[model samples]
Target chain A: MAGEASSGTFLQGLERGLAVIRAFSAQAPSLTLSEVARDVGLTPATARRILLTLEQLGYVRTDGRQFSLTPRVLALGWAYLSSLDLGELAGPYMEELSAATRESCSIATLDLPDIVYVARVPTSRIMTVALGVGARLPAYPTSMGRVLLAGLSSSELDVYLANMQTEQLTPRTVTSASLLRAAVDQARADGYALVDQELELGLRSLAAPIYNSRGRVVAALNVSAHASRSTPESLCEEVLPHVLCAADHITTALKHRGHL
Target chain B: MAGEASSGTFLQGLERGLAVIRAFSAQAPSLTLSEVARDVGLTPATARRILLTLEQLGYVRTDGRQFSLTPRVLALGWAYLSSLDLGELAGPYMEELSAATRESCSIATLDLPDIVYVARVPTSRIMTVALGVGARLPAYPTSMGRVLLAGLSSSELDVYLANMQTEQLTPRTVTSASLLRAAVDQARADGYALVDQELELGLRSLAAPIYNSRGRVVAALNVSAHASRSTPESLCEEVLPHVLCAADHITTALKHRGHL
Candidate 1:
């Protein structure tokens, strides 16, 4: 509000439009006119106006009486993807790790207090991790998030740890600041992290930081498996090595491409 | 513009703010105050206004006098990627094909006039086709795009082809609508498409339609190789079989997951 008030020319409509678009999701991909109004906390008339504008821009589409997102909404993602070289540089390496380990692999970039899975490769096995590209997991308890956090400066990590809201996701989720700091410190020392059954009941993951040419961690690469399939020792001994190799390869490629 | 005007209550401020955000890119990851105005074709005052508003909303950050995008932009892409099941279901198959051929493999859903690469697996050795996960390519010439187009009903294809603008990217680019239609027809008849030197010289690709449980082609999967490495015949003989099998695996997985 300070920035907007100081600049003195805020675009309230754009903010509302973005808010309305964000209101629809996996559980509420399709919304009736009244539902959109209720979800966005706007009057029905105002919500209808925003929806109509979004529909015109090809960001929203309607089926009969309910509104749903159109594929054109992908343009927003395209804009970010096209502008970022990290994904391109890390792609092959992620593929290699997925093949070598025979498990689902992913790359995530930290987005505030959560980690957003930006890229994922499933291994054609029947496994449930409840994580997908763009799916967010609390940073305190996820392997990829912790690996990414390890790269942050000490002061930045302190701030993050201070703001972290400890919640019980599962019995394994870390809730204490001192414990979280120790986990992050271990990740910093070892160059990898393992999260077992913290976010999901049977999910386990091993992750290593994917560094840019500057040796800064811009993303984290991970291998996720069901608890039955991947033991803690096996994942660290076997899967982590492969993932680190792949991350090293990706970092070299990024350096060659001048992404440093 | 027509769509917005018809709606009778358009948000011009939101449009201008989004345009300002879109002006930044990988090369221009951070921009000075004047640079933002130049790219978006707005006055510096107007650009400053939008930028300030965005900063207030946590979408943009200012470092001294320069402006850059924040991780919050990922929120927009996260919205789309999380809502769609295609990218998650198609990941492993794409990785397998990439590993087998040592080339980039992609899964794309058609957005008219363009195809957005929803998921991709890049091969380490080749950097020629390093399209990122959410990059977009012209639909008229890409192997994956044509395969998806071939799945559309005849009337739908007719309408799409009529409005398309084909820019010649290479000597082999299909500039004739009828010829392009014929190619689509051939893909429909054969259930696969091979496009060589159309979008990029020395690039050859093979693609197949990926059907959901209801048997609709919701996406297309493709293997792209250097022309010198793969002849059209070799692609058909070596890659087509695996492409088809990977597609079948994804389709079956989608059904089991109830994504269809």
Candidate 2:
């Protein structure tokens, strides 16, 4: 899209159909026909056609008025997750990190304004929101997101910040683009990002990047805990080293597997 | 498809596009242009259009000759997994079962001739084949498959059997349709299924059905182990009780969550 010619070959029907699927998020799992249309910015008739197509394909299920997705949808993702091998590759290191820190460890990559968790190892601390695989968090406020942001090229980072919609999730959340840019720069310089009580009131986490064989940052690994579990200084002193080591181990594993 | 009238407004483009996405699987993660066209039963020109659209949309990536799926495809599955809430609901139960048996615990539902793993709590035993979430296995030989197949109505099960292409994965795998039917009935009668060295030479597992509040069996939960760890007799004598209890707990949780 940035440089290539997409007009002659682009498939609008495919795009619209996928957009309709995207309209349903964790916050709004099920949506009425009109809601889907509105969310995807399509007409009612167009939305209905796409929804009906998806329903016919067993990807979407409708119960009279509202429509939701089915487990069959996972078949679409199985190809990607299995091929990427991130979850299987990162699982052991994450579990060890979780055990050592007595907290959850997650691996995530950037997905625009949000960071999507690709894998996780939990210490059984159930939070208000269930942060499982494929869970997303705003990139501006999360340690993993900041590390991922730091991995981006300067121009790409500038473009993301320009389009980012920052929310004041906590009192410490930095909403200004200039400050967020500076934080990303600091993360790049320090080789890690420590976010304290920014994403949530009682959350403290630090993250480091996982590189591929080519030495490009492919994902971020983070150890997340309750603020009461450790102060920011103690987290840096105690957990940051483990976080960095685990991330590097994952990177080395990726290289050993010949993934660039 | 059995009874519904799908005349006009089926959106063939959407259908074909999704078919292209489904062409990639764990065994065949990447495909060339002609391979995609041949596998998907689409003309090379049409397949090229869909592939280009997916590439621009960030779901597919190609390196000159071979095209593979990207993690962005996980977004499509995220909607369904999160909405179903099974992974979150079944997580704690699966962990407990895995801990108790010192083996991997998984939950799966029927998807035609296959059972797709929806949730799993794994032990750190790296196998030749990595079994993680979204992994699919032939339904004829797995304990979970038998349990789920038993849950289907007689007519539905018959239809599935008629279409199912059973392969003798191991010497112990039952390939006869009548024998498979008998096995499913036995599972239904006993409220559990134990598959011994059927899926693989050294793998053994026993599964129990997880029912919704409406008493409809929605998923099957299983504890899978190596034959060295447990004999068929010991698995039934020592591990069957925990597997049944854990699956029942998941059903209760689903009921509490008002899934049905």
Pick by DockQ: which candidate is best? Answer: 2
Per-residue lDDT tens digits of candidate 2, residues A140-244? 999999999999899999999999998899999988999999999999999999999998999998999999887788899999888888999999999999999
Q: Which candidate is the best by lDDT?
A: 2
Q: Candidate 2 chain B: minimum summed lDDT over ten consecutive residues — where?
A: B1-10
Q: Model 2: which residue pairs collide? A: none
Worst 10 residues of 1 chain A by lDDT: A1-10
Candidate 1 residue pairs in clash (backbone atoms < 3 Å): A14-B14
User: Which has the greatest TM-score?
Assistant: 2
Over B150-243, each residue of candidate 1 has an lDDT whose tens digit, in order, gives 9898898999989999989999999788999999999989988899999999999998888877788878989988998988999988888989
Estimated TM-score per prediction? 0.76, 0.87
Tell me model 1's lDDT, rounded to 2 decimals: 0.77
- What is the C-alpha lDDT profile of model 2 across B144-243, one tens digit per residue? 9999999999999999888889888999999998999999999999999999999999999999999988898889999988998889999998899999
Q: Cα RMSD (Å) per model?
A: 5.6, 4.8
lDDT of 2 at B207: 99
The whole-model lDDT of each prediction reads: 0.77, 0.83
Q: Which regions of candidate 2 deviate over 4 angstroms?
A: A1-8, A25-41, A62-67, A95-103, A124-129, A256-260, B1-7, B25-44, B61-68, B100-102, B124-129
